[model samples]
Structures are given as C-alpha cells and as structure tokens.
Target chain A: MSDQQQYLIIASHLREAIQSGELQPGDKLPSEARLSQQFMSSRGTVRHALEKLRAEGLISSHQGRRSQVLLPALTQDFDSVVSFSQRCQEAGKTPGERIHSREMIDAGPRLAVQLQCSSSASVLALVRVRLMDNTPTMVERIYFPEEIASHLSDYQSSSGSMYQHLVERGVEISHAHSTVTATAADADEAQALGVAPNSPLFVVNQCVYTADGQPVWCSEQHYLPELASFSINNVKERPSPSFFTPGRA
Target chain B: MSDQQQYLIIASHLREAIQSGELQPGDKLPSEARLSQQFMSSRGTVRHALEKLRAEGLISSHQGRRSQVLLPALTQDFDSVVSFSQRCQEAGKTPGERIHSREMIDAGPRLAVQLQCSSSASVLALVRVRLMDNTPTMVERIYFPEEIASHLSDYQSSSGSMYQHLVERGVEISHAHSTVTATAADADEAQALGVAPNSPLFVVNQCVYTADGQPVWCSEQHYLPELASFSINNVKERPSPSFFTPGRA
Candidate 1:
C-alpha cells in the first residue's frame, strides 16, 4: 500500500476502536514510538494519523501525558439543519413525536413583531414532545406564520417532519442560531416528558432563518439534560499583534 | 437623517433603553401601532425596526403575549475568538484574573494526547478564576507546552492574558468551538462562586485552535447560570419534500 494510504488505514482502525468502545473515554494511548511500531508505519505517518483524530475531536494531547481519548463522539453539526428523527437515527435509536397542540391564533404585539405582520394577522403554533427510544427527550414549541402553517396542517402530526413539510412547500430553511441554558423542568414540561419537576433541562431558544436571512421559525426546546450533552467545534484566531493593537488598527 | 436611516434610528433608541434598563427583561413593549405613531414613521418601518431588535436578541416575541424586552445586550460574537477579558471588555465590565495555580506537571494520558507530545515531557497547567465587575464569574483551566509556558511565566500569575502571552511568543491563538451544558455545581465551584452546591451551572467545553488548525488548548468553563444565558442564530436547510421518512439524509 502507498505510504499515505497506510496512514488512513491506521486512522480508520483507531476510529473503529473508539466507535466500538474498545478504547474508553479518557483512556491513554501508547507513545508515538510504540504506535509506529504497532502500525508498522514511519513515526511521521503515525503522527499524521493521530493529528487527524485530534482534529476530529476524538482525542486530545498534553506535553507530558499520554494521549487520551475523548468521550464517545457526541457531536452535532452546527452548520446543518438537524431534525430530531435524523439525530435519533444517527444514534441508532427510534424517534417518535406526539403533537400536543395545534392552533391558529391572532398575532398579539409580541408575535406580530416576530412575523413582521400586523397584530390582526394570524400565526400557527405547534407544540410537540419528541421521544427517543420510547423515552421522552424534548418538548418543542414552534411558531410559524399562517401561510406556512396552512401548508403544514394536513400533514400527519404523529410522524411528519415540520422542517420537511415547510421545505416541500418551498419554504427555504437556511440556518438557525440558538441560545441554550439549563432550567428546572417545570410542571408542564415534567408531565410532558415524564420527568419530575426540577429535573435538569436544556432550554434552547432558537430562531431559524431562510437563505435570504428571513426569520422563518422560532421555537424553544427543553431537553432532559442527562439524555445527551451538546457539542460544538471552534476555530480560533491569533491574538492581535502589538502593532495591530487598539488605536493603531 | 436619510430616509433609509429612520428605522436604524428607532432600533438604536430601543436598544439603548433595553441596555440601560429603562426597559427590563420580560417587560412588554408598546404596540407596533403605538410605536409607529410615537416614532412618526410608517408601521412597516416600525415593524422593521422591531424585527432588527429581535434578531439581535434584545427582544423576544410570543403570539399571545406582549413583545418582552430582554436583558442588557450580550455581545454574542460566536464567530470571534472570545476570551474572558475580551468578553468583559465588550460588556463594559472590568475584568480581572486571580491565578490559583501555574506550574509544570506530568502530563496525564488525556493531556498528553491533546498536546500530541510525549508523556514524559513537561506541560504547563494554569488555573484561574475570572471576575467581571469584581464578581467571580468563571473558572478556567488551561494547559500549554513547556516551551510556550516558559515564555509566559515571567508574567505574574495575576497579570497577562494567556492568549496575549502566547501571541508574544509567536504562538497562534486562533478560534474555538464550545459545547455548553448545565451541570450541578460542585462544592469547590459553589464556594468559589458563592453559590449553593448542586446549583445549576453552565459547563462550557471548549478547544482553542491555531492558524494551521492545530488544537492548542482545551478548557472547561463553569458559569453561574443566573449571570447569563447562551444564544445562537442558525439557518435551516430547505426541508426534503417527503416529511414522513425517518432517516432520509
């Protein structure tokens, strides 16, 4: 095999080991010399493989410590629009949804501003509880303009994906940013999710947009914290040089 | 003022009221009709101004409720490499650091792996609690290679930004992605931040990167939840035409 191809083989094997739970979180890896010998590759090649894993968030390093494995790869793609069904499927779990409420209401001062319409206009509010592996995981309250909701009401609520429904109706789902916080499960959330009040919950406040940057949907999702942890990858910028310090830029 | 700037003027004025606490979080805003009459602009212009504010996270909308104002503005710059000092500065808060530990130590397996170095090599571990407006807000643990730390040791534990220190030594401090979760505050964190043990705290897991995409630093920041909430803005993809499929990619 080519030298470069061999490194990929090495990386894939390690990745599989991680995926299979053979190497647990916080587990240490052997030295580069030992890994090179074991993989039957040059030291540089082994290093290359390790670097790839590190970049993928599978491993971390320190100067004097053995390389340690990160916890099971529980990462969410920040750039993509991920549906509950898609997320559950990726984890090999079953996804189910039950609609709690669907109503068309007059836009009050608050929602009128959000939909960018007059208070007299109407909006459709849909609330649902999502289940993963038969256990309730999240409660979502979504609001859409009447135009969008009219196109979605006839769809099956039990298994239909609103995102997909909107998309089919030619509504472009571009991107969303969310503000997340931890909150005590209120009585309503606890009852819906089958969890006790005061249980730790993840409250995600989200605004979804269209490619043209129109606010298409807004929702608040409350998740049971122990169900899963959220993850994000970041790219940092170098600190401003002295020459580029304030007043000089 | 230019006609195109009218909306901006009204938005900025409302933003100041929200930021200065003239309008508090959860407080209702005057209706759009009222706002248009007050601002002497078209209702569409007023509505546009409100949408801008909502998009910036200074306000929130609910269908049947009043448009509630949010707390003082948070500089939610997800794209930028945000440091405690930088964040505090942006919020007009005085930032200070009290270093608790700064020493070279044996790298553990996990630390070694993250740094991609030999386990026997020394690494610098720095621990600090940061203050905003003289209130302890977060605890940060950082690790660096020995060579990098040595160059920074001259700066007293209480002085110097680690990112700045690294920059001075030609080490790049690029960007970071962070995962935020709500965890029960431990005893140590409770005392340090003067909160009760088991209080909800935001655990931010982050990795700082270099220009070449090298993972240089990993840290876990614990925040007092009452102090803030997290926020992100995202765009959704065009949903697939079929909404019933569970795993259609």
Candidate 2:
C-alpha cells in the first residue's frame, strides 16, 4: 500500500475506537511508541495518523502527556428554553456556573428597549462563565429587570440554575428570539473561555420574554466552537420565519 | 476628550450611519482625510474608527481605497426549509450557483447510514459554490440517490434551484435536521468560498427526508461568517426539540 494509505488505515482504526466508545472522552491514548508498535508502522506514519485525528477534533494533545480523546461537542437544541446547567446534565456531564460579577446599572437606550423599560431604570447585569465537567465552555452576560433582580441576591452564593430561580420568583418564560453568529473572541472573552485571542466563537444574542409578551431580559452568550453545536429541524409547513427583525424589538 | 474617546465617538457616528441606512451596503465612505475634516478628529482617530468597524464586520477596506459598508449577515430562519436562492431574493440580492462538479460514487459507510441506503448503492455527488451578488458566500456539497439525480439533467445548464427541481419531480421534502458548527476552513473550502485559508467558517450539516420518512439527500454547507447568520425562535409550549440523536439513525 502507498505510504499515505498506510497512515489513513491507522487513523481509521483509532477513529473507530473512539466511535465504538472503547476509548472514552478524557481517556489517554497509548504513547506514540506503543501505537507504532501495535500498528506495525513507522513512528512517522503513526504521528501522521494522530495528526489527522487532531484536525478532525477527535483528540487533543497536551504537553508531557499522551493524546487524549476530547468530549464530542455538546448539542444544544434550537427550540429549547432550558438552562445551560440542565442541558449539560441531560448530556450526562456535570454542569457548573461561576458568577464572575454582578452589578446594578442604568439601562442604556439600547438595553432599555429590549427590556421594555425606561433608560434610567436600574438593571442587574450578571456576568458568568458556564462550565461542563469543570471546563469552561461559555461566557454569558445577562441583564434582568429590577423585580427579577431582587430575587437573585442569593444566586451568587448558591449554585442553582437561573431558570429555576426565576421560576420560583413567579417569572414565566414565554419565548426567546436568538440571533446566532460567528465572530473572533475579544480579549475578555478569550480570557474567560481559556482560548487564544481571536479564536472563533459562536455568539447567541437572545431576547427573552415573559408569558404576557413582556420582554424580561437580554443575554449574550459566547461559546467555544469546539465545545458546542446547535441543531435545528425545519419543516415545509412552517417555512423558516426570520427571527432577526433588524432594529425592531 | 481623550484621544481614545475621540475615536470611539467617530466609530459610534459611523455605526449610526450604517444602522440608519444612510450608508447602504457597498457604499464607500469618505476618504480618511475627509472623515478627519468632517468629524474634527485627527487622521489617526479616523483610522482607528475604521478599524473598529472592520472588526465588527461592518465594513471592508480594499487596497488604496476608502472603506465600504458590507452587506449585513443574511439571516436564515431555523424553522424554514427554503432554497438559498429564495432567501437571497428575499434579502434583495441576486443569488447565483456555480456547479463545480458532479459524479456518481458508491455510498460510503458513513454516507450510507445518512442516506439510509446500502453501502454499495450509487449516489450522485455534486459540488457547488453559492454566490450573492456574484460574490461567493458558501460552498455546498450535496449527495442524492439515483431517483432524484436522474431528473437533474438540466441542473448544470440551467441556473435553477435544486429544491424546486426535486419538488417538481414529486419529491416532497418533509423536514430536515441540521447541525450547525464553526470550524476553520480547509484549503479547498477556503478557495471555493473566496476566503483566506484557515478562516473561521460556519458549517451546516443537513439531512433531508421525504414524506415517507426516507432520507433523500445529505448536504454540507460551509458559509463565510461575514456573510450569513442563523436565527431561531424558541417558544415555551412547543419548545424546540433536540434533533441530534447520537448513535441513532
């Protein structure tokens, strides 16, 4: 077989192992020397195979350790109104939330429109970094109105889900309109997400409303591309309606 | 004002102009010297403001020319099963598709599962680049079974919508499951999409099913981040369901 074909064979074998769950996420693969021995291939060929897997995001390499299988991207439902913590738990991973900061600020004209409040209205701005399996996956900045903000005093001290907290406070989430775009991470986002500057990020700008059609909050969530994916199901009857109404509430 | 504040003021003014439709897409702004004169700011401040706009994907600069406003990202509805051509037309831009290649190949194991056919079944593979106003925006590779492929003789000669063609041939697209992710573009994708190599791309993997619940086509669409965005509306009662069923057909 050609040298390229030989390396592909080795890569396919490793890929199959990953697919079959023989090598679970976070499990380290054997050392390159051991892999070379088992594959009966040269060290260079084995290295080539590993590189192929890395490009596909199947494995990750760290200094002073063998390559490890990466957790497959967490799938987020397009139509779900669940919290990040709930989604993570549903995927069989422990979810964590670290509240970086919380402060009350005057809602600016832009935010005031989204919140359906006056510009001078006080809004609670909460910055948080969400974690899956204790690894930072996304940074979220959420703004809540004064009434809802009053109930969130214990949020910082407690590790409870925000959706649950809102529910307990008599808030009924009706729907959310989300605009999903891709952009390079800014410096603050890079630091919070533990990625290099200018890394690609999937951004979701969401405007959430209450059951009575009152806008409740606006959130901007930035997720690492490698850690999250979104799924949507589209049918013919309801042709995709554009949720992004530019400059409209 | 501080020098930094001066530039920020300039950026906000330009941003307002873009948002208000005063500066339409493809319209060139005044020269840097003129901007400096108009805003009563230094040339450095004008350049800084332009850079900020560029970072936000609002404008593009060509060699030795004033920057021009970019067409805002085209928003695709998550619930719609519309053709790209129709979407572009709705956005008031001419849509074009250039078919690069078409061939028949044996369905591989991975593709066979998606197509719900035998691995030895013949599949028609087509490669095309989608364009907006004659500028390439995305590259799509689609696979179809023989039944649909047989009626696509005019696909190459006529600039028509594939979805329309299939519908005319009695193919009723029931629904499609789409997985969206962000990744760095490969060399081939970069070339086809007219983007820099390694540029971040929004990729959508779609599996289209017919009314009989049979998978009819599979497509991989790689979009330039600057050109497209996806929108989803999640409601409380009929919440968005997760379409990603791992390890399932």
Candidate 3:
C-alpha cells in the first residue's frame, strides 16, 4: 500500500482502539519508534497516524511524552433530557446503577419548595452511585414527592433505569432546567470514587418538570469529569457577544 | 410573617452569598444550631432555609455534616462558537491571554489531511496561557493556516481576544465541533497551571470551521476543571431500557 493509505489504516485501527475503551483513557500508546516497529512503517508514517488521531480529538500527545488514548466521545444532545443509562448505551457501553441509599424521608426546605408543598410533606430520597463498566462515574441524589414516588420504597431499582420505572408509573417527566458547576471533590466524594480528595467533579443540579410545568423531581448529579461529557446543538447564533447590547448590533 | 416566608428570606440571603463567592465552593456553612441562634429563628426554620438553597444547587449537606456551599456556576454556551475572552466578558469579567509561544511550522501529514492541504504547507502554531480573575484558567494551543494569522506574529496578543481579531479581519467563524475528555495533567501542563502534576483537567479538542465549511483552526484547550465548566442542555424523552439503543424510545 502507498504511504498515505498505510497511515490511514494505522490511524483507523488506533481510533477503534480508543472508541472501544480497550485502550482506556490516560493509557499511553507505544512511542514513535515502537509504533513504527509494530506497524512495520517508517517513523514519519507513524507520526502521521498519531497526528490524525490528535486532530480528531481521539488522542493527545506531547513533544517528549507518548500519546495517551482518550475516552469515548462525550458529545451528546444537550437540549434533550437524556438519562445516564441512555448515554452509556448510545456509546456502546453497559451503564449500571448501584443503590447507595433509598428511603422515604421528611421533605426538607428545598424539596418542599420544589414540590410546591410544605416541609411536613413526605418525600422519597433516592441516592445511587452510577457506574459505567463498573467504574464509579457519578453520585446522584434524587428527591421525588411521596405522592408521586409512593411505591418507590418497594421498587427494585437495581437492574433497570429509574426514569423508566417512573414513566411506567405514569410520571411524565418532560424536561428539566439544569445548572452545571465545577468543584473540588471533598474527602468523602473523592474517597467514594477512588480518586484523591479535591479532584474536580462536575455537579449538575436539575429540577425536572412535567409537560404542564409542575416540578416533579429535584436531583443533583455529580460526574467524574473523566468518565462523561455533555453536548449541545445550536442552529441560531450563540448568545451575542457580551459587547453587543440590547440597543446595539 | 409566616414560617415559609421567613425560611424563603433566609434561603435568598444564603443563595446570594454563594453566588457572590463570599461563601466559596466546599466552604462549610454555619451549623444548623448556630444559624438558628444567629438568625433568631427556630431550628426547623433554619433547616428549611438551608434545604431551599440545597435544592437550588446552591449548597449541599450530609446527614451529620454541615452543609457545604456548592461550586459557583461556570457555564459555556453549547450552541455558539465564541472565544474564552468573549465568554468571560459575558460573565462581566475581563479575559486575558499571555502568549507563551508563537512560531511558523510545517503542517504534518495528519494535519495536512484534516486541513485538506499538502503536508509541507506552512502553518502558524500559537500557544497561550489563558487567565480569568487573575488566575490561570486554561492553556489553549491553536494551529492556523499561516496566511490567516501572518499578521498575528507582530500582534501583542496579551489580553486580546482571537475571535475579535478574526472578526476584525472579516473572517466569519460560523461554528466548531469539539470532543471533550477528562485526563490528568502532565508535568509541564501542571506546572504552567499551578496545579499538581497528574491533576484532572478537562481537555477539549476542537476543529473550528468557517461558514463555507473550511477548517479555519484546530485547538486543544486544557482547562483546570476546578476553575471552569462546559454546560449544555439535555432533553428527556424516556428512551427504552435496552442497553443497545439509548436514545430510541
């Protein structure tokens, strides 16, 4: 094969390795000399394959260090309220959930306000550790009104998606307004996720509402920044640059 | 005032404190007993107020631990292709850049393919240390067609926005597609960003395209996850529980 076609083949094979998670994120690939030997190509040809992977966001390399394999594509529909399970499956991975705690509790001040009721109301607090490929990915805490999740206490939430369970019970969760923030994981969370305390985590706070606009659930999802990513699609222009005012162009 | 009104007032105050960064992310709030004593209210009322802030993604609490302030919002527009400087300005802050290195280099095989050009084509490589609020935020490495950024060699890029420069030059940057991943910082990057080596950083590899679909630039932006966030809207349609198809309802 010609040099160009040979490099393309090498690049394609490497890209598949990355997408398949066979070469996990942060796992370094062989050096140029090694890749050249392994692929039976010249040093120049091996470098070309690496460069293409880097350009496509599939790998990252440094001047003196070896290139590291990246995670599967984190890009997803940002405007659609998709579940963690759905996202993982879309990426061809098995998404699992481990119930950390599930119990009915007194509605606290925030849950009460979001549920549009008094603090004395009963609520179901569901806490779970979500996983992808057995790697702890997120710690989610969800609160639903007892009137809504009344049967949650007895539900088997281990094998399937919680939203699916809710939908089956007639909870029409249509959309959510979410706020995302960055924070240093505290000792507890970092320990739980097997990372150092103070490691960064993306915290997503979401308030789900029904089609009729009634708030149903207030949930907090904290993701290990390395395991997942969120995406958004925009057809119209982005919010005008900050310099443009209402009266100005 | 009624009990709910009093709690709401306290919640609002706490929310403002968190938003202003006076109570920073991970800072512990006053104990429930202390808050009630300080505010001259019942413990139930203080608890109620704290709960409201928690529900709004402003704070978090453990069963036995004091509630910690949630991280401040660090959001990126998912739809529009805007520069980091523009985003900072939108948040009402000055964005700054320190050019670390700039040089003209030969485009390699992979880049040549991505740019749809010859491998020996000349390119301008730009690396800048981006800062916000007097702290290092991100390291952006941009590669451009030499002809496009030729004048930038003499340009004092300090505190300047590249997007603004491109616009001034009549370049219409319509959109970009980016792949996001999470990885540990290396020795050089860790030292530059003042974070520990191997600390987690959000790596965004982006290929920016013009209105006519030409690749204008390719960049790799590494952000200190603790210092920034990328936010996107997700939709909810209750996809089926099948592990193979995540988005199909």
Give lDDT tens digits, candidate 1, residues B55-126: 444565343445666434533332223466655666677777877788888878888777767888788887
Cα displacement (angstroms), candidate 3, residue A9, comes to: 38
Name the top DockQ candidate. Answer: 2
**DockQ of predictions, in order shown:** 0.13, 0.14, 0.07
Off by over 4 Å in 1: A1-82, A104-107, A119-121, A191-196, A210-214, A226-233, A236-249, B1-82, B100-105, B118-123, B157-160, B175-177, B211-215, B226-249
Per-residue lDDT of candidate 2, residues A1-249 (tens digit): 644468778977987787688987557889989999998888767866775565344566343468776533222342234477666766687778888888999999988987889999999998888887888888899999898788777764233378777777788765666677676778888898887777777767887766444666789888887777766545443223233221122
Better of 1 and 3 by DockQ: 1
Tens digit of per-residue lDDT, candidate 1, span A1-249: 654467668877887787689987657777888999998898756766675555455666454456677544433442223466666776688778888898888878887776667898888888889888778888998888776777776777454367666777898665555566776677888899887666667666666655444567778788777665555433221111001010101
Question: How big is the positional error of residue B6 in model 2, measured in Å on the Cα after superposition?
Answer: 61
TM-score of each: 0.59, 0.63, 0.58
- lDDT measured at residue A52 in model 3 versus the true structure, 0 to 100: 51
In terms of lDDT, the poorest run of 10 residues in model 3 chain A is A240-249
Which parts of model 3 are misplaced by more than 4 Å?
Answer: A1-80, A105-122, A133-135, A181-203, A233-249, B1-81, B106-121, B187-194, B224-227, B234-249
Q: For candidate 2, what is the lDDT?
A: 0.69
Task: Please give the distance, in angstroms, between residue B123's alpha carbon in candidate 1 and its true position after superposition.
Answer: 4.2
Residue A35 Cα positional deviation in candidate 3, in Å, after optimal superposition: 49
The local distance difference test score of each candidate is 0.63, 0.69, 0.62
Which DockQ value does candidate 2 get?
A: 0.14
